[model samples]
Target: MIGAVIGDVTGSSYEFDNNTEDYDLDLFREGTTFTDDTVCTIAVADAILHHKSYESALLEWCGRYPGRGYGGRFQMWLTSAVHRPYGSYGNGSAMRVSPVGWAFEDLEITLAEAERTALPTHNHPEGIKGAQVVAEAIYRLWRGEWDKIQELLISSYGVDYERQLPGVGVFDETCQGCVPLSLLILTKSTDFEDSIRSAIHYGGDSDTLAAIVGSMAEAYFGVPDTLAERALSYLPQDMREIYEEFRDRFIPTSSLEV
Candidate 1:
């Protein structure tokens, strides 16, 4: 989704060195580039669009984008001829699952699809759960259940959005740490850009966190036209084409209006 891509590009520069809570901070810097988050997200959308196997599509895309700063286990999987689940519980599962939320009409189907997508690599229970929770959140947001969004996340995933955690700049990669924070950021956001800024403000694997937040925020508030165009400019032409086609097929045009 464009939301995930925009978040990935925006947060790429802040992954290390500088982490801030300043919402007015520059979103895109000179060295910013799409990472594994955007690559895998596009892979998921490609798989769904072409009716191909998730594993195969993921493997192909990972192969195509070898230097996209993938996580260790995922990097290994990309190179290995043997494709097997590594039982990882990293937030990678959740980061790449936004497409599942959009591809299905029903919540149950979206959750199931998310689980299936994660199982090929992140077969750990926590990984699957993380993907399912994010996918379900996006699905619910798309369904326009904004009023009960916090209640739904709390009751469903036991995520305590109100609990105070470490301050921004503490890096955490575990699904438990990042997913909840990403959701909480979304809860506090005022718009699509704010959602990404809020997530990045939390630091620690910022791109993945913002990608997760941005995906849900896109469903809830829709992407701003200027923001979307700026984000698209960072993507390759092929990716931009896929994104356009995917959005045309799945998201209604009215939902994209600012």
Candidate 2:
């Protein structure tokens, strides 16, 4: 979960930037901070930790943190009293789904919970699939089944791993536009930080892409202490508490790396 937060913070400054050509860019600086991605991820973790409904948690968290770059439709959903799914197929579902991967041990349960997380706002088929695939990928990596992710994507989602990346600055917010690219970046990353850098280098919807890929990378390559500590510093006290609690409850001791 911290991995996802780290990715969000690191990529926050370059969401739609098309001029950056340096993959070795400084990760954090002025203007770098957590966005809706981190808030929603923490909301998901809070829901799992406290046994609250996903919708309720999302409402509370999003209400607490307004104007954090929420998509137009989601922002409308936040203010409206309807409190229902909006049939969105945006990457928002995928960006906020890392907790589903960490909190469940069973693949079926994980997939089911992933669906539940998406259903509140992203009930469209592509939206649900985006959340499921990202959660499943992380869960599989958590279980040491990283080798199977490509096969799962190919067989189930028909993702062509060899497809070319979207051009820099080409923004596509839909699930179908970003999820496959995130998985492809994960496949090519050498470590946690590399996965983040790769996502930012690819450019479009940087924070969301990195959040999705970073969660999977965290399952595969535990975040470095420096990066983890730096990332945590960007979060507020409440978010940090939830992150620490989730880390204690679901994160495995064996995955820690020096």
Candidate 3:
């Protein structure tokens, strides 16, 4: 998705040593490239192309990507070439989750796919829950159900969301900790840049966190025509095509403000 790509590209520079508050399009322009976040998600997308079932899909995805910065348990599965579940709640789920929200037409189907897709790597409750929240939120936001989405986020996650988010640090990458916060990041913004700034302002797990936030934000915010054109110019032909296609696919059917 463009959200993840733009975030990944935009936030790539700050990955090594920077606070979330330091945000700018200049950062994105400075040598951004796709990392494991996009690669593994590509594998996930690849797997889905092969089969509809989660087990089969993940197995295929694992084979294709073969472990690029995968977590402990996932690495084991990749190297061993076997199906396994770690029951983790890592932020990796959130970064790769945009597809689940965009791929299915039905909300329940989207959430179902989210849970199903999550099971192989993050079968734990927190993991599944995190993916479900992101996929579902994007669905509603795309449908112009802003208030419903906002209500669901507050009721399901916690109160003082805006306040709680900035406190969650870069090390707080767990699904239980990061996903709702990621939701808050997407909810708090008015546009693509502001959405990304919200992630940086929150100041934790920033690049990946921002990537997750950035991808979904782009989905709803609908990148500015000029920015999108310039950003596209920076990408390679193949990836640029993929980005453009995904932008259309993930773009919400309705326009709404969060």
Candidate 4:
């Protein structure tokens, strides 16, 4: 989705440089490439198209992009043929969960699909919890449940985010680091640019953080025309086309719409 893609491009330049107080000038300039966000989104899309099951999509994503810079725990999940949901609670699942919100027709479907997709690899409660929370947030927005978005996101993520994170956090970018923090960025953000920047400004695990924030921004804010266009310019030519196709396929028009 545009959310994850924009986050990938914007945060790509800031991953190794960890200065929350210092924001980069050209960090989101132009021509930034998609990393794990776009790749994993594509893999997930392949699975969704190939099979009706969200679990199928999760497995497909794991296999399609083995070297997608997945966390060590997820890499383990990706490599195994005979695998169970190894119970990884990584933010990787969160970073790539935006599509569930867009693809499904209602809130229940979003939650179920996100959970199903998350559990195959990230069956750990925290992992499934993060995906369910974000997907429900998206579904609420999609269904015009704005009054409930904040309430659900907070309760589900187990954070009382009175305000989006005040500044960058230093702990590992695990669910503890990424989930609530990304929610904070999304909460405070007013638009596509602000949302991605807010997430990137936090520094650690900037890419994943940005990806999560960006997805929510798209789900709620519906993405800006300019921002969406710029996000696409960053991908490789081949990938740009694929990204466009996937977006056109899954986003914009809902499956329930004529």
Give the TM-scores of the predictions, in the order they appear: 0.95, 0.96, 0.80, 0.83
Clashing pairs in 4: 164-184
Cα lDDT tens digits, model 3, 1-258, are 566666665555556545444444354546565565665555445444444565565555455554444567766765665567778888777777777777788988988888877887788887888888877877776666767767877776677655544364556768767777777777778888788766755565666777788767766776665545554555556445544455465545342123
Which is the better candidate, 3 or 4, if ranked by TM-score?
4
Worst 10 residues of 3 by lDDT: 249-258
Model 4, C-alpha of 245: deviation from truth (Å): 3.6
Q: What alpha-carbon RMSD in Å does predicted model 1 have with respect to the real structure? A: 1.6
lDDT of 4 by residue, 56-156 (tens): 65556556545655677666666677767787777877777777777777677778888876777778888888887777776666566767866775676
Name the TM-score of candidate 4.
0.83
Model 3's alpha-carbon lDDT is: 0.66
Against the reference, the lDDT scores of all candidates come to 0.85, 0.89, 0.66, 0.69
lDDT, residue 202, candidate 2: 86
| C-alpha RMSD between model 4 and the true structure | 3.8
Residue-level lDDT of model 1, residues 1-258, one tens digit each, is 778998998989898845465768788877888999999999999999999898998988888878988988888888887988999998899999998888899888888899998989999998998898889888888788887778766875575544534457877787777777787788888988889888887787888888988988998899999888888888888888888889999987766857
Q: Judge candidate 2 at residue 109 and give its lDDT.
A: 99
Q: Which one wins on TM-score?
A: 2
> Which candidate order results from sorting by TM-score in descending order?
2, 1, 4, 3
Candidate closer to the true structure by lDDT (higher is better), 1 or 4 = 1
Q: How close is candidate 3 to the true structure, as a TM-score?
A: 0.80
Query: After best superposition, candidate 3 residue 49: deviation in angstroms?
Result: 4.6
